[model samples]
Target: QPTLRKLVGGSSAPQLPDDSVRQLLVEADATNELFKYCEGQGYSLFVAAQPCSYTTQVVAGMIYTVSMSTEPDPGTYYEIKIFKPLPHLEQKARVTEIRMAQR
Candidate 1:
């Protein structure tokens, strides 16, 4: 199951969005970044990347490993890794890797 963390200072405060929420956002961002790092390189995804699933690695920062599929093309998926540095770092998030996923 996805974990939900505390969002506000008090116990009664609402919970933060879980991994599923993060994955949806990541899918959108990854599609845009794909054009940046993948288009000319041969990854010509003709449609929006629909989120399939994703995993997260937490270190000094967070690495999001996302699997997405392009519409009208079943069985074709791409793996995108995005890094989000700690809040203290003040660094902008970036897409570290974008590649086709083997079946």
Candidate 2:
């Protein structure tokens, strides 16, 4: 998956429309807020994935998994994961395909 920074910067990357760019920016802001919240809660943040444009209506943001303790005991380790979807982007699938025939 290409990061938003690379997608918007590289010449070879598909040029996104202005509205899509704006939407991506909004998602980025939301991601930042989530990071701050995790920090305040005393958990170390790890970004599992950077935000990426999934489809015309959707821009998926980072996946975060946070953990606080480093104890070797399994019971002492706990992790909280979070990924917030863009509300406006959530939609029903519009297309379905059967198996493609091989030549």
Q: Which candidate has the top score in TM-score? A: 1
Pick the lDDT winner.
Answer: 1
Candidate 2 residue pairs in backbone clash = none
Per-residue lDDT over 1-103 for candidate 1, one digit per residue giving the tens place of the 0 to 100 score: 9997744332233234367536545544667876676677766657776667666666677776677677566666777777778889987667888887656
Clashes of 1: 0
TM-score of each: 0.65, 0.24
Candidate 1 ranges beyond 4 A from true positions: 1-29
Clashes of each: 0, 0
